[model samples]
Target: MLHKWILAAFVSLLGTSSLLADETTQARCVVDDKRRQICLDHPAQRIATLSPGATELMFAAGGGDQVVAVVTFSDYPPEAQAIESLGSLTRLDMEKLISLQPDLVIAWVTGNPAEQMERLEALGLKVFYLEPRRFADVSSTLLRLAHLAGSDDVGQQVAQAFEEGINNLQQRYQNASPVRVFYQVWNDPIMSVNHEHLIHQVIELCGGDNVFADLPRMIPRLDTESILSANPEAILAGGMGEENQAWLDHWQQYPHLHATADQNLYFIPPSLIQRPTPRLLQGAERFCQALDEARAKRQ
Candidate 1:
């Protein structure tokens, strides 16, 4: 009777262990930016990033080794440049992407083509969409991507660090004096971002008020007349390339403008500020310093 009882207990224990294992495998589910839940039977071993920002996020999430494919301009971290490129943001090389056979694909919600993303899903590839518009979103994206890539430990560390870094900046500049600013997004069309855009948030963070904050469009096309009328205290711009300072130089042509008068036109690297990645913190630091100099000139 004792022997029979021991055998039954052992069998029950084995059954419980098997059930727990199954539960572990089924628990992998993360909500994408689209508010859709994406699940995988197992943590993804093969991953693909479809945008430059997505590539940087995956690497920051500690999933660099898992990335098998990437799109053009996914050049940050330097190592990503060597990865197989599926093509540009607008057009992807479908055949090459398919050949890679990535179990998971990280896509940009606004940057990537919607139809192509649908086709990837239709083909049975798991797609996780990321659209990090806020600072908190960046940390959350790292957590989610790391969870999918089985790098949660590293992801948590990175996410925490980013949150802390941004918090530090917020605290440092929370009481800073406001400087009226105009941030030029593009030169040919004379574009600037509205208050709703992330760049505007960065401006606010640095205690610089966006001159076009009340503009209806996110990226509004402005004429030189409107800019001259507003006459912002500081003008910040990113150029076509990382080291290009010509955009700021263009402001010099308007010698009477407050920014140009005070020589407050600043050049911020497009990759650091324009892309919503960890490097944005570095950009914010530079932007804040520039604003401080603008303030100093007043004294």
Candidate 2:
């Protein structure tokens, strides 16, 4: 049984609308993650993305030009950096946001502050809440967002490509030997994801067992002692930036550990893995290759 949120998102994806009620003026309608029917009288001309992932997804849907405002750290696709920033997700500049007058607001359900989204909805802005926790959700969202922006052609192509890529990865690694994996989302407080997290699914896809998948918390804060006890054969981490190796390096001190002794510490760029978008295919590939290397060490 899937979580209600994931199930609703999956159902919504299947009903993604591509047929415009009127070709001259797109009457875009979508059932967002919140299960609310959001129908724009016309195609969304001015769009505001309140999260980095949403900004990336909007661009993937070929609505880059329609994106008038974005929150901080939306630096993916390189072009997103040039868009006007409405500050971070939590502390949005309402004055600047209102001035932009977005017809559509792509919001992150869990990432953004609830009050801010409520305010936007209260002001009669069409808010599409998206929290993609599955691979299918990511690809389907591309098509759904594209329909909203009147860019169905590009959205379909991108979404199809994403689906194909994920299928290929799944086919390639589905029967491979499972490797024990510990994925470190954050090191200081020692945050790791449970089975509910998309990253855990990535691990399973790559034939890796997330040692902490059964933890009740979605992202559980762990300790070095507990990690040592679990004894994952390979450890993967994402750091502050693409090139930062400090997080992985920190584990070198525990040379007695299987991962450390075998030098199986790997780094997958946080931007690619952390964000739930088409880019995850690239992240998943990299992750699979890392596990392959870890398996090689055992031989």
Candidate 3:
């Protein structure tokens, strides 16, 4: 009877140990854009953003304090500028990145070098690829990043607000008259976006037709003659700085063009529009207002 009691107690202790181990090893899983399942034993405590957009997204996800490193020009949320630098998007300080000991790294699909990401992965670091092209993608990515950082509550609030803002824009512009628009990304080469670009989506969202939306490349380079031929009704350019109007002024020389003749020149800050994050709602709102002003001019 003494041996039987001892054996029963040993069995119960072993089961309790197994249960404790299982409880300590809980895992969270998320599927990335590349369609790979990434599982972590626990929420990531340290994160590194490899692009300006990624940095902004991290903040939007309510994981700003967890971000230990970022690339150049990550000036949004103001707090990001103080973070450690991993160099620019094209160049990275691998040594500094390793020293940071980030549990997770957010990489831009085409922005970050493939080889560098591979090296990080080989070193057993988890990498999450971000390339948000649509408004839904912008919000969903925030939620995903927040989930990884164990800040789902903040992430969900931000994501919901972004989606709601976009829906409001769509409803407000539902009956707006369409305007012909020309968006200049660069002044020298006269770069414009194709229909697949996010800017084109913003144009359509504002009830505007992008004259260069049918271009073959994602970002196509054109000549001044092309603009003269298209003669868009409104010209919107994101200049070098927040208030630089030189790009718009250059169009004043072409008085014969519809845009210049009617003075439908507007400026939207590049940072607000260029980076795919929660801030895009502001850019889209500005774009809709500009198109509305152009429509009023026609009357």
Candidate 4:
């Protein structure tokens, strides 16, 4: 009876998967090791990106025209400004989404909850979650999404350029002292990317030593005193918006930090820093250029 029960469960799972699979097989797309489902057949011609990062990636993959709708915060590229606005990635406008009738929904793992994605899938919408974690993963994610969207050649071209840019940046800054960097993502409690995160990868690529590299947590909670103790050389305020500005005005409180004395504290464009997309290479290159300029001025 127990064996029969296990066999029945297996059959049920297979049946459910088959039922879902019958809904759509628009394309065959490579899924990365992270299990990001990419559709190879239909190619997401009428697409709705869930967040700014996904928007940036979609543009990079040459799917600008296929993008029928975007969420509220996808304001970087001028093209995105004209697209229909859904709600924020965290809180979607289902009604708006339904109206757009996107063949594929390029959703986010972090911003959009899993429940909403499941709901969309249950409604027979083809939603693929292409979330990536590290800098090395960005190129793959872009390429994979491009292939899924039927822009594989364009995606590969962009990925190659991005990779080449990173290589150039690393070579240029190969000899510099790894500037001790504290990249501020959130300000109220003083937070930074956890070690092993993609943003942290950007820091390393730009020849900076992450102060929190050894910390056990990815988004570890810490107090101001802890930040003071870390005493980073360069303070990068990746202001998500006005909220990150407090750090820019208040660093004077900790006069001992190397950044304060040398006036090395600065803000990189959040669009480039916050997202794990091709633009992050832009962020790395910008940081390297800034560090070079800072060095020249000091000399």
Total clashes for model 1: 0
For model 1, give the 10-residue run with minimal summed lDDT: 1-10
Candidate 1 deviant stretches above 4 angstroms: 1-23
What is residue 237's positional error in candidate 3, in angstroms? 1.5
User: What is the lDDT, from 0 to 100, of the residue 66 in candidate 2?
Assistant: 94
Who wins the lDDT comparison? 2
Of 3 and 4, the candidate ahead on lDDT is 3
Clashes of 3: 0
State how far residue 164 of model 4 sits from its true place (Å): 0.5
What does candidate 1's lDDT look like per residue over 1-299, in tens digits? 11343234323422443336546564466778887767777778889999999999999989999899999888899999999999998899988998899999999988889999999999999999988777767777887787788787887788777777888999999999999999998998899999877888899999999999999998899999989999999999999888998978777899999999999999999888888888888998999999999999995
- C-alpha RMSD by candidate, in order: 9.6, 3.7, 11.1, 8.8
Q: Give me the runs in candidate 3 sitting further than 4 Å from their true place.
A: 1-26
Candidates in descending lDDT order: 2, 1, 3, 4
Better of 1 and 4 by TM-score: 1
Q: Which is better, 1 or 2, measured by lDDT? A: 2
Q: How close is candidate 1 to the true structure, as a TM-score?
A: 0.89
Candidate 4 per-residue lDDT, tens place, 192-239, comes to 877767778777777788888788887766777777888877888777
lDDT of 3 at 65: 90
Error of 1 at 129 (Å): 1.1
Give the winner by TM-score: 1 or 2: 2
Candidate 3 per-residue lDDT, tens place, 98-209, comes to: 9999998999987899999999999999999877777767766776787778787887788778878888999999888889999999988889888988888899999999
